[model samples]
Target: MAETELVCANRECRIAQGGRCIEGHDDLAKCLYYGNEPEEGDQNEADDDQEVIAPFNGVYLPDAHPLDSRRADRVLASLPSRMIGVIGVHDSGKTSVIAGLFDLFQMGPVANIIFAGSSTLHGLEIICHDARAASERDEPHSERTKRGEVRFYHFDVLRDGLLQSLLIADRSGEEYEEVADLAANATTMFELRRADVITVLVDGRRLASSRDRADVMGAIPLIIQGMAENGAFSRKPNLAIVLTKDDAVQASTRKDQVQRDFLAIIDGIRDAFASHFGEIGSFVTSASPKDANVVRGAGLAEMLEFWMKPGAEAQGIRQHSYSGRVFDSLMIEEAKRG
Candidate 1:
């Protein structure tokens, strides 16, 4: 490391002589362009740490698909990681939030967090495609999580100068509503049982409507009670009551009223369930909002930071052993009878 070394090995960045960074960074060393150029015979060394996306022999890597619980275990076994489980009703903006976080990384750092890499790059890109201008859609739309079993999207990020692994579980919101309908259904949500953070989303658009608001808000208590009875919070993970589609609420004429209602729900949940969780918090996010007035990814960075918090430490390895779908119809029948 000599003063003569160019930023990121770029010849034009004569930083030793005070040439500015190509990316306008004050310190050339912090610039993306500022790194050692791959030295001769260095490709093999770099591949060794390639987020396990490296191929078996340069052409046999695992498909970049969402990780199942088993696959997720293999990754967790190798790296220190945090698991976040997102639960909500239909169209609650789960996929949009996940896709928005991915889109933010494409532009550059988010909240000063560096995107190191992802194990499910293709899967992440697929969810984000329709929302991008590249899709040639007149209006952007998020791809909803397909109704099925739970799957995880893995991201390796460098935050606060340290590399950390994040595993965010994605499941159809309809499926989560089923758990709200029957507490016993929660037993099948192994992801939540294993989660370090469990985020509950309420649709901000619904919050803006007087008629629809009650149904939407009422579901929160039912979902939490169901999960609690099923032992989903046995480990006491951090609980987050997240309001999605803040843009919708902002556009409503009763914006102030809606915001207050949302805050009231957060406070009520805290008072009611403080003992059931390790920590309880709330967040507002407007990920991939269609309203032009709303900053496209507003509040997502803060939401991501919350997920990255050292909340309820991760529990021991997950013990779910489902063959196909984790949903157990027999358990639901029993719960109904009881």
Candidate 2:
């Protein structure tokens, strides 16, 4: 390299070497230091002004994802966690319920429980996107869980100052329904065997139609029966028969009759599976509602509280109300306000 003195004061200018301003100025007169002498500064000061880049010491990690079946056990081994398994037929709003709870935490404390933290923020955000105005969709919807792509979302919450870890499993409803055909189908769904709370969703929209009501009401028992035959319940976990899409049912003409049918179905499930479950409960929830009359995330408080604390004698459908916790609860007042 030939040693050449700079023609301008600006250290960045390469006019002497390239016959043009390195700063890309169109006119020579326009250059700030075009006709000025370069400053004689301390070598240290020149070194300090130069950009210094550090070496690439660390590798980039991928975005956080929901826990897989293999990883679920590892998390459970490290932390004292509770596993929640949500089961339903296709389009039963199973995924929406999980997404709604995550949405509630974004506001503040739900049912008064603090929004502590989540392991799968990306997964939750993906499910929640379509329901928000940012998605640019006219009607809100939940992204359906793909078959065989089961994942478990984790939430670490403070319950009365005690950090309670929760692992909520998500999978396609079609997969769960497969267990009804053969008990062996549940072998792939090992989460069910270890679940502390098993929530079976009843689609309120299906219940609204007389044609679909009977079949919809009958589906839950078959799921339970097959799982039971598979020895899915080694220990009796608390059972929550959640009536999802309450807003849809609210907007229907058969609202009253649907509610009646829901109760009857609950009673039947209780009597049939009472021996297999620790505490049998029924809850009504509308995660994201189309009807203005029905509140978003309605009745999730009771459902969550019930899941947290077992041995509740839940005989009927839980109303959309939040009762404070003497023990741990979801203090859902803030979430319900929306």
Candidate 3:
């Protein structure tokens, strides 16, 4: 029998039993001490396979910049457009109403309007962050929206296979408050002037609170008066008076009184600016019914439905009109009364 040859126990040793190591001392090209090393290409492919792909569902602002006007124009050109303006005071649930509308569309289509896309997904996300975080943490907290940043959320309205575009502008409540207090014109005021529909948000919680009631009720007429003085309501947009935080009001023992007070405020608006508004409708919404601390969206469908319908079709719900001469007479009468 031939002499027994000793084989190296190192699995990485490339040399045959009798072959010269190429690693200087033997025929193998490398040393077995470092173990087997994969080829560069193989390693790269392995890394590629392990890489994670992120979800790209919605479009966001570029570096927190506003949406491009050219892009907006291009979108508007192809489809019939409707512009909705949301107006309210600070902590009056403007953002919550917007967040609720966004949430409603995202879940599925709203009546005939389907979710086509949004240029302000990140903006919506920011507004709804608290509600989402609360749900995740099993805790409740209010969502605070940033001020001075007015963004537009775009949607594709689908009806009978025809697609139309709807753009809703979410303005900062503080901005409206400034205009109301100073009686000055701002960029948001211009948007309001051109909007096809306007949703005026009133915080029901504040309405129910005796401490905040006066200021809350006082602010509504001021905002409307400011807008009217600045010609923001010149085009006579359809109006939806949205009462937010409805759940809070309903739960309170003083619900009847709060409702009465809110109705009185609405009647005052009708008397003051009836001719400047077309097809006015009142809506009560609770954006966050499940968590009292954070506002989500509830009773938004009816509000959206009111917004989506045409002025002529919605005439039955009209609480006001756009009578130019009558409005002038009313303003004159109010001035004399003052």
Please give, for residues 225-250, the per-residue lDDT of candidate 1 as tens digits.
88888888877888888899988888
lDDT of 2 by residue, 1-338 (tens): 99756477786777887678876787877878877886777445887878598888999875668889877777788666788989999999988898888888888888767767777888889888988879998888887888776789988888788777888989888888887788788876777878888999999999998899888977788888999888787667898999999888878999999999999989988888888889788899999887545677888878888877744242334555445655345544535322
Candidate 2: C-alpha lDDT: 0.82
TM-score against truth, every candidate: 0.74, 0.74, 0.67
Candidate 1's C-alpha lDDT? 0.83
How accurate locally is residue 322 in candidate 1, as Cα lDDT from 0 to 100?
59
Off by over 4 Å in 3: 1-74, 133-143, 186-188, 290-296, 312-338
- For all candidates in order, the CA lDDT equals 0.83, 0.82, 0.72
lDDT by residue (83-169, candidate 3, tens digit) is: 788888878887667777777887887665677766667766666666665457464345544675556767676766776777777
Q: Which ten residues in a row have the lowest lDDT in candidate 3?
A: 329-338
Q: Could you tell which candidate, 2 or 3, scores higher by lDDT?
A: 2
Off by over 4 Å in 1: 1-58, 313-338
Ranked by lDDT, top first: 1, 2, 3
Instruction: Score candidate 2 by TM-score against the native.
Output: 0.74
